[model samples]
Target: MNIVVGVTGGIAAYKTVQLVRLLVRDGHDVHVVPTDDALRFVGAPTWEAISRNPVTTSVHDDVAQVRHVALGQAADVVVVAPATANTIAKIAVGLAGDLLGTTLLATRAPVLVAPAMHTEMWQHAATRANIATLRARGVRIVGPDSGRLTGADSGPGRMSEPETIHREVSRMLAAGADLDGTRVVVSAGGTREPIDPVRFIGNRSSGRQGIAIALAAADRGADVTLVAAHVEDAQLDAAHAHPAIRVETAGTAAELGERMRALAGSADVIVMAAAVADYRVADVSDHKLAKEDGAPVLSLVENDDILAGLAGARRDGQTIVGFAAEMPTDHETVLERGIRKRRRKGVDLLAVNEVGWEAGFERAENAVALIGSDDQVVAEATGSKREVADALLDAIVALRSRP
Candidate 1:
């Protein structure tokens, strides 16, 4: 495979050296593209020697070959390690003042970025928006992991280890359209049950996991219908951009159930990943309640079991998977709940994860256990949402392949 590793300015640039070495050891044709500022940390000599491919920071170095565009055009994948805040912003907006920028703009191949910076910068609204923009364009983001940083600072601004980056790149290179010819329906986000015109009941689901699932299936060549309920706009951009995915929105549990039912007939696989409210206010207020009106009486009604309905009505050879987000006292308790839910819902598989004020919901990382029909834990994964998504999909593929 032809690989392009883009190195940006950051202390983590040193780690990218090992990343290039790993790729070269695997017999891949590795090309290193470094920004002028990146060379300050890891010199051009080190990159050139490690990759065994001439390295350059300026587009003028090989103007005759149009190296900037040629490298990107030839690459099977482009990885930017130590992707700094500045570089991230530049890439988000298509700034091509540097060679690496030009190559990035010219690439049609999949792009994976590993971010590294201060926690403040990482969490800033501007950076978040920029990250969202990159995701919208189908760019894969590894991590700015939480840990020790330069001096006394620390948080989610440390670039992922070189080995970690290498592993992800390897997976990207090895990925195939395994889900080709399959039709999948995935419901994501937390449904909003209206209480009044200005307010509603909802969960803290960022819809990142469900969106990751949809993206994973689509990347594997599945035609996907993503039924999203109250998902953030930034998170929805990727699904909307994916040609293989069709995005549909719903507000309440009932609306989500209706959408799922409408799409269920054509789906080979159905995943109920949405956080549907078990109850909704029986009577929605047409106007916002005033403070002087005192507390008004409220009535709650049970919602339909959408997942169970889908599982019960499943066609032969069709697969139905459900998600359970629990606040359990222990790991065993979570698994026990998952098994019971799987059996009760008649689902082929149930992905169970513990959630609380800090653990799940709105976070980038997740831990999940896949409970199978045999009342056994088939797979357990703890990592980024994308990793968990692939694990669930892996179980799905395995279940479908059973004779």
Candidate 2:
């Protein structure tokens, strides 16, 4: 594989050296493209010696070969390590002031960036918006892990370790279309039950995990139907662009159920990842309730169990999967609750994750345990949502492969 490692100006540039080493050790043809500022931190001689490929930071260098575009055209993947906020902003807007920028613009391959900056910069609204834009365009982001920084600071601005980036790059390269010819249906986001014209009841599901699952399946060559409820346009961007994924929208639990049922029959695998409300207001006001009429008596009714209903109506040979977002009680573990729910729903698999005020919902990362039909824990994964999605898919692929 041809790998392009774009090193940006940051104190963490030292770490990217090991990342390049790992890729070269794995027998990949590595080309190092460093920014002029990056060379100040890690000299060109070292990169050249480690990569065994002549290193240059200029589009003007080797213009005869059009090396700037040539490298990207030949790359299977492009990785940017210690990606400073400046570089991120540049990439977000397609700037080509330098060799790295031109190469990035030239590549059709998957681009992965590992950000490293101060906590304040990482949390800045500008940086956040830039990251979102990149994600919307299908650029893979690894991490600016929470930890010690260059100074007496410790937060989520440290670049992920080199080994971690290497692992992610390898996974990207090894990804295969194993799910080709398979049909998958996934429900995502939190359903909303209307209270009035002005307000509604909803959860803090950003739909990141479910979107990740759909993206993973599509990447593996599956034809997917994604039923999304209340997911933001930004959150649905990649899915909408995926050729293999057909997206549908729903506003409430009932509506989501209706959509899922309509799509379930033709699916080889059905995953219910939406956070459906267990109950909804019995009465929905046609107009906003007045302050004078505030504190009106309200009644709640239990919602239909969408997952269970789907499982019960599943076609032959179809696999049904459910998600359990449990806040485990004092007497029961998350696993126990997950197992119980799996049996209750009659799902072939259940992915259980503990959620609370600060954990699980609306977060970029997730930790999930996969419970199989045999009532045993099939797999446990804790990482970015995309990683957990792939882990669960691994189990699903394995389960279907069994005679």
lDDT (C-alpha, whole model) for all candidates: 0.91, 0.91
Each model's backbone clash number:
0, 0
Model 2, 25-114: lDDT tens digits are 999999999999999999999999999999999999999999989999898899999899999999999999899999999886778999
* Range of the 10 consecutive residues with the lowest summed lDDT in candidate 1: 326-335
The residue ranges of model 2 lying beyond 4 angstroms of the native Cα positions read: 8-31, 37-74, 81-96, 105-168, 283-294
Point out the worst 10-residue segment of candidate 2 by lDDT: 132-141
| Model 1 error, position 206 (Å) | 2.2
TM-score of each: 0.74, 0.74
lDDT (10s digit) by residue, model 1, range 1-403: 9999999999999899999999999999999999999999999899999999999989888899999799998988899999999999999999998889999998767789999999999999999989977875568899989999988987889999999999999888776466888999999999999899988888899888999999889877799999999898988987898889999999999999999999999999999999999999999999998889999788999999999999989999999999999876645687788888899999999999998888989887789999999999999988768778888988998899899
lDDT of 2 at 242: 82
